[model samples]
Target: MLIDTHCHLDDPTLLASLPEILAAARGAGVVKYIVPGVAPEGWDGIARLAEEWDGVCPAFGLHPMFAGLYDEILLTRLRSFAGRAVAIGEIGLDYLAEVPRERQQAAFRGQLRLAVEAGLPVMIHCRRAFQDLLAILREEHVQRVGGVMHAFSGSPEVARECIGLGLYISVAGTVTYRNAVRPLEVVREIPLEHLLLETDAPDMTPEPHRGRGNEPAFLVEIARKVAETKGVTVEEVTAATTRNAVRLFRLS
Candidate 1:
């Protein structure tokens, strides 16, 4: 079985079809999923999903794009519920988009501290802010509980740096794209123990499914691509990634 380390089933796009999506994912060899919390508004839905599905794990954190939602109230809520959730994230820094960098970093730091206090792993979303992200993590000392670099998009050298910061490099459907180079190199070179697989479903749909929104069901395609890149079998990739997910999130 495979664990989709990152997916957004709470999004309205997939919420309505969630049951069918999970069935298809099981048919495609995916049995478990990690649903990350990006916005406070979506926390209830994701929390409810975790309750409804035996295989769904929940993560909560304020994403860079939603800086407005980060506050003491949210932090209190995160502190209250962190123990129940598998992880604390869908959180990190992003410079690619026009948002308040100072505010985003503050929120990221606040959540990182929350994760440390809550004693849970973190799921990070980094974009065009790798150096800053690393700097902040180093300052905040995120290695205390470790984290995952979701939908990783960096060179092998940067990937190594992230690993050094105590993070697992998770790849998405982008690995299957013909134009993918950096992620392919990282996947090919990174140790299997440090590698993870995800779909970032409802967003980064892999090839053939590129035009449409992604779902956990398409995780098989990403895993197959990882296996091909690493010169291993799909089952091997599945086992390693599932183990990675289980270890980081403390999933049963």
Candidate 2:
């Protein structure tokens, strides 16, 4: 079975065809999904989806792209989902975003603290700000409750650094792209034990399916590419990644 470690299933576009999407995913052996929150307004909808679906796991957090929306009110709401959430995330620093770095750091740190307090892992998002992100993660002592670096497209060296801090590097459908030099290198260099698979559905669609709306069903393409890159059987890649996901999120 495969677990989509990161998917925006709660997004309205996907939700519009929930039944069909989930059916296709299950058919492809994508048994579980971890849906993360990007904003306060989406949290309730995510919670409801998790409740209604057998394999839908929910994670609550504010994404770095939406850092300006972070505040005490959002934190309090996130805390309420701590007991049920698999991790605290879809949170971290995004230097590309126009939001002030200070505010993004503040939000990321707050959620990290909450993750620590609740004894849960995190799902970190980072881009062009690894220096600051690493510094903040260390300052917050995040090694205590390690998390996954969601949709990681960083170098193998960066992947190693995150692994050193007890974090997992999650690869998305981008690995299937022929032009994806960096991600392909990462897949070849990083051990499968520290890797997780995701579709980042509704985005990051894999080859042959590019320009189409992504879904968990396309995760098979990613697994095929990872196996091809690492010179392992697809079954091995699937089993190892699924095990890593279960262990990291403490999934049943």
Candidate 3:
């Protein structure tokens, strides 16, 4: 079965029809989904969803895009949530956004520390700031509980570096876009064992579904693209990615 390693099910659009969305996903062969909390306000919802749904798991952190809302107390609160979460995530740098780089870095570092302290894997959200993120990981000596780089859009060289650092490269629905050469190339280069699939649902919908709200059910298209890119059977792609996710998240 397929596993969507990163998605925001708490998004209002999806949360309003979660049962329908999840049923569609199951019908499409999606057996599991990892929902990441994007800010302090979303943490409880994500955690509760994880508790209520056997197929849904949670990751908590402050997204760089939402860094401005963070405070020192949020870190403590995140620590407490980590006890019930599958990972600390949707956390990392995003230089492309208007948020100041320093503030983003500070928030990323704080959450990274919390992830380290809690011994939880991370679900990193990086955008136009791989080098800086890598540097922080190195400086912090972050060797334990490595995690996935969600919607990875880096070069093969960067993919290698992240893999060397004990991280998985998660390919999103973007790979299915006709013009997304780079993400497709990354998929071709990264080993299946180090690869995971995500929809980042409610966004990043694959081709044929672009401009529409993405959902976990569409992960089948992502898997189909990965299979074609790697010249493997769809079942093989599903099995490998699912195993990789289970290993990365320590999910049962």
Instruction: Tell me which of candidates 2 and 3 scores higher on TM-score.
Output: 2
TM-score of 2: 0.99
Candidate 1 global Cα RMSD: 1.0
* Worst 10-residue lDDT window, candidate 2: 171-180
Q: lDDT at 151 for candidate 1?
A: 96
Q: Estimate each model's TM-score.
A: 0.97, 0.99, 0.97
Off by over 4 Å in 1: none
Q: Predictions ranked by lDDT, top down?
A: 2, 3, 1
- Put down candidate 3 lDDT per residue, 15-83, tens digits, no spaces: 999999999999998988899988888888888898898799988889999998777888888888888
Which run of 10 residues does model 3 get worst, by summed lDDT? 137-146
User: Which ranges of candidate 3 are over 4 A from the true structure?
Assistant: none
Candidate 1 displacement at residue 135 in angstroms? 1.0
lDDT of 2 by residue, 62-92 (tens): 9999999989988998999898899998999
